[model samples]
Target: MKNASFGVLLALQFLTRIPIPIAVPWTPDTRRWAVRVYPLVGLMIGSVLTLIAFAMQNVPAPITALAVLSVWVALTGGLHLDGVMDIADALGSNQPLARRWEIMKDPQIGSFAMLALVFLLAWKAVLLWALLAYQAPLWWLLIVPGLGRWAGVALLVLTPCAQQKGLAWSWQQSLSAQDVALALLPLAFIALLAPAALLMWLTVIVFVVLVRWAMMRLFNGINGDMVGATIEGGELWLLILVWSWWQFATVSPPGI
Candidate 1:
């Protein structure tokens, strides 16, 4: 159990910029077990963001939205967003597969990457502003972040890694079907906790399917960049779904 705790901690450290004061042992075994804890790490991120939103309750919606969004990006050090950009660069290159991979690997960001980042950040800000405007429940902040990471776990379990090397393949080799099922237990529990959560859960599954299809069609397999893009895209999709649900719930009749 100590080892499991360490694995969870390791996952938290890896997935966020937050400093963990504990001493952790880095080992092959730990790396494998860490994959299962990603959802937990995501929950931690969501919890922090939710707390931030609550603390800023008196602030104007747009300002609070940007502050929350900034912290959200800072939490992960924009790791997943980097992937989103890289994948966008690769896909927009209009090159052969080999060259596209090269483009993805390039250190410099391209036009497509810039455009994607702008749009993604803008979309997130708009939805967050809406959430704040409605005085949405604090739990709303938790659902999407947690579901995004869960979607990632689903991606890892359901899709094959494109490369033989790197973190994605290493986790793929170590992780199992049973571990994936185990990771989902928290998602089910959370869904049962709130009506919005149920819709978020369903939205996550849909985004996962959409991401899987896009990965297969474009990359022919999955990699870390694809996983990252999936995370960002999953979060966006969840935010859109949740925001829309909140709007409908507020505007519609109680019976309807």
Candidate 2:
């Protein structure tokens, strides 16, 4: 592709059924740029879900919430959530590191895997309940998931890969300061779009700290699972912060 950056994003959207395509090779450089542009995927995802939620708002609240969740799940093909499930199952089992790796590697779902999916879906449901109830600031959806994916990009760019080669390594190896710099540029421009631009940075900071701690305790180093988990968890953490901020703004008085 002429522009590797958009090509990378095209690849993500291609995976997500966004109707974009890569006529050229999915080169390492292109993949790296995709990581940078990964936020756009989130932006698209959030936008679609928000619009669906907005359209269904006059519909029953629960129905609207289901529509939002349905579209969100459909957009990404449930890839990140799958990551969240594998990682959660691995973590919940309290198995040794090697065994955990084996479990993560296994395609077959386990009890913990089932638990993880249930918990994640439940959390997303509750979160959507709050967001749909109040109908969260649509702009934040644009910023939060975009920034969370950036956190995943930052993590890959910073650390050495646990495995020698894979899609994750393709990213780890291909990414550079220039790519990271370019990625931030669009986000910087987004600050003018909303104050949540700064809150987005807070999401990055929190993910880095929390993921670093979790990786050290759980995985001991980076892996594809880590990438997926970071994207999913960081998104949730950022959303949780947004909810807390909303609660702060409008909660009723104690005397009431």
Candidate 3:
């Protein structure tokens, strides 16, 4: 297979539970290319979930929200949520940076992580229900995950990795101007689609900047977990903004 074709499979394999039968060599170049196509993985996830939700449009909003959330988690294998939990544990440790790093690496879930997981998941469900209840455009779902992963890509290229080793370090060290440019093509696609999408892209960029600053202040740099957390955070923010717009627009709001 061509490198581009292989890169697509690699991106899918890395981002979701989807199986890609082709095996691609795991070189730094391949990894960079895979990251370049990361947004495509989001597009694929959003398309499936949007279709499912639309098919069940007649179902109660709360139940539809729960079902979509379940599929979203299963599709990504809770990859970003794990990052959220790790970062929460590290941040809540209140220990020195070194100890906090160790705490992040621990396999056991801490109380902080558990509480964060509960709140984050519940909040996401609530936001999803709001979107469903409002009868917002389902096509916007295609933009949500892409924006989230794009935030991850932004961190990968723009931030310094806190640790001397790990996937983030490797990606940062290997990233090139070309990689950054290629990764951003998805934003152009979003911008051409609608004014709301442009707004969504801007929101993701702003949130990524804020989160990147927080990571530097707390962790001294970015990491795999921080990147993952950024993805989840970006997605949540997009949902909220879309929901808010739907609620306040000239159209009548849906009955709760």
- What is candidate 1's CA lDDT for residue 163? 76
Question: Which residue runs of candidate 2 sit more than 4 Å off their true CA positions?
Answer: 13-15, 19-23, 252-256
Worst 10 residues of 1 by lDDT: 247-256
* TM-score for predicted model 1 compared with the true structure: 0.92
Prediction 3 TM-score vs. true: 0.95
Tens digit of lDDT per residue, candidate 2, span 1-256? 4566566655476437555544656677667667667766666666677677666767766667667777777777777777777887788889999998888888988788788778777787777677656655667666666776777777777766767877677667777867656666657767877867787686677777778777876777778778777877777777788778776886652220
Per-residue lDDT value at 174 in model 1: 69
How many residue pairs collide in each prediction?
0, 0, 0
Q: Which candidate, 1 or 2, has the higher TM-score? A: 1
TM-score of the candidate numbered 2? 0.88
Global lDDT scores for all candidate models: 0.83, 0.71, 0.86
Clashing pairs in 1: none
Better of 2 and 3 by TM-score: 3
Task: State the weakest 10-residue window (summed lDDT) of model 3.
Answer: 186-195
- Cα-based lDDT at residue 49, candidate 2: 72
